[model samples]
Target: MRWALVLALTAAYPLIVYFSLGHVEPRYLALLLLVLGGLRWLAGGAQVVQARWVALAALLLAASTALLNTSVPLKLYPVLVNAVLLIVFGLSLVRGPSAAERIARLQEPDLDARGVAYTRRVTQAWCGFFVLNGGIALVTALWASEEAWALYNGLISYVLIGTLMGGEWLLRRHLRARHARLQA
Candidate 1:
């Protein structure tokens, strides 16, 4: 139930920005971000990463909204989000048990050396993907048309992520089957 609300909020974020910009006061949008941040923190179980990033986002949006009163912050929101994700996934590498491995463990807690290695590599791939995608988002926000930025950030980027996720799932299946065969 909570997850559903978060998903709904996330999906509507760009649209909110699109309609709100110029039509609404920037402070209202910033306040909405702050509210969303609170909801997100609660929905995410208040994980440290989520709390910190969401807070930072709310703060940044508030500052930009109040002082700058421009659409640039809305444009940049996705990039900040990407940066947060990159750090979340990338930093796990240092803390041990990469983010992918941790998630995989929820399904297969008895992961062997090979599974561990595979998940680690997958996490690294995700990190690299975030880096590239975030760069594109940054470029789009900074230099592209508003429509183009909204298209990429609001829609096309999710498609690309879906493609990446689907591709990774397919590869993981093949690799898992190969590993099973080797064991057999």
Candidate 2:
């Protein structure tokens, strides 16, 4: 139930900001975010190091927003999310097993050298995407109007993510078929 509420709030974040802009004070919104951070921290988020860091970041952002009494920090949440993702994906590339390889191994435990290479390339692609996306997100947060910011972060970003995933799936399928033909 707590997870559900958290997820709902997180998903509705853009809309919440968009609607609340005029009527609600930014500090109150920051308080809500602080509540969310508290909930996450209390909900076993600390067990996972990544989640703990995310929760801490959220708490910090909320605190900053409260202190500044500005909506800028609230607007920065998407930028923060993208930065975290970029770090995670970028680190996986530097570390032993890339994140794409890790996820691929879940279904194909006997992943070959070729598969390893492919996943590594995919991870690199994702890192690039994150860098681009994060840059745009930051631009929107800082300079764009609230409506524009919400439009990109809330809607367009999801579409771009879906498009990337779909394109990858299609490419993977084609590569698998080509490999099978070569083997035959």
Candidate 3:
């Protein structure tokens, strides 16, 4: 499936860049960026409004990657992405709708006051995660070995995100069930 292929490419991208450095032609990095961006843009056509930011990020990545020297830029892409995420989440906490609220509304437009508060907390959690992840990514790009960078950014970061997401889902489910029982 398309999602499967996208995930495979995403999971493999850092490893490819890390290992291919000095082993393969630099032009290949540009090619890979184009491919990834094109794929995201195409897939983004059907996405919801809040999620459209991802499409924009993909386009930016492709354009910037094409223009920059691949040597360091390729390694720094994840750092750039995490920084963007940190900003987006941090901004949401200030004045506008929380990122978690936007995402929750996608599924529950009439979510209750409790739900809104809960989503805000979830947003805070995500902001914290982004800060931590972005910090590690910054360190990786600046000082870590290639293998360390690739391993943390490529594998560990994804796992941590999944764990956070899964934990949130489980907690939300438990809260929802408890509320339903109370109402009954």
Candidate achieving higher lDDT, 2 or 3: 2
How high is each candidate's TM-score?
Answer: 0.90, 0.91, 0.76
Best candidate per TM-score, number? 2
* Candidate 3 error regions (>4 Å): 1-8, 37-70
Q: Which TM-score value belongs to model 1?
A: 0.90
User: On residues 1-184, what C-alpha lDDT tens digit does candidate 2 reach at each position?
Assistant: 7777776777678778878988988888997788767766667442366656767988998988889888888988877778877888889889859989998999999999999999999999998888888899889889999999899888888899899999999999999999999999
Candidate 3's TM-score: 0.76
Q: Write the per-residue lDDT of candidate 1 for residues 1-184, one digit (tens) a residue.
A: 8668766776677777877776887766877677666766777663666656666786777678767777777677778778888888888899988999999999999999988998899899989989998899899888998777878888988899999899999999998799789989
Top-scoring candidate (lDDT): 2
Off by over 4 Å in 1: 44-46
Please write out the lDDT profile of model 3 over residues 1-184, one tens digit for every residue. Answer: 6556655776788888888877865555766766765565556543433235654665566566567645555666677657667777778889757889989999999988898899889989998898898899888877888889899988899999999999999999999899999999
Q: Where does candidate 1 have its weakest 10-residue lDDT segment? A: 45-54
